[model samples]
Target: AQTVTQSQPEMSVQEAETVTLSCTYDTSESDYYLFWYKQPPSRQMILVIRQEAYKQQNATENRFSVNFQKAAKSFSLKISDSQLGDAAMYFCACRSGSARQLTFGSGTQLTVLP
Candidate 1:
């Protein structure tokens, strides 16, 4: 079984600043994918970043990066140069290599303060 947890229910960051959202997962499967998704007011799930269980290097996409700690089952997302457009509901998700379904966290609403 695999599960994802986001400790913070909400987060706020100043515009043009940075924010880090925390996430943790528990999975018995050795092969899996950890992901951070952002859902805006339109309710579209956009992939922010992803990390493969077997990959030793963390994943980074532009201003979005992840700090993945396999041993501790931690996958945190760092958003640099935050903008108003970045405000959304962020979710941490996990999927086993063999599974088609993704388990997601409750989500953390990000507020970008101008």
Candidate 2:
């Protein structure tokens, strides 16, 4: 079974700053996928970023980027120039091509202070 882990239960960052959330996973499959999902107060799950195991280069989306260490099974999300809008619950998820389900971590609550 694949499992995602977020050691931090809560984190805070000021507006216009940068924050990095740590995430680690355990998977048996070599071709699995990793994802960072953001859930705001509105309760909508949005994809922040994604990384495919086969890809050597890390995936990035605008101000969001991932530091993916394939050998260590670690995927961390870095929010550059963080804004108040970035304040939300970040969830680390794992999925395989053969499975429809996504294994998510407990979630890290991000509070952006003005």
Model 1 stretches with alpha carbons more than 4 Å out: none
The TM-scores of all predictions, comma-separated, are 0.97, 0.97
> Per-residue lDDT of 1-114 in model 1, one digit per residue for the tens?
888999999999999998999999999999999899999998788998989999999898999999998889999999999999999999999999999999999999999999
Q: Considering summed lDDT, which 10 consecutive residues are worst modelled in model 2?
A: 26-35
The per-candidate count of clashes, in order, stands at: 0, 0
Q: What is the C-alpha lDDT of each candidate?
A: 0.95, 0.94
- Model 2 over residues 10-107: C-alpha lDDT tens digits? 99999999999999999988778999999999778999999999999999999999999988889999999999999999999999878889999999
lDDT of 2 at 82: 91
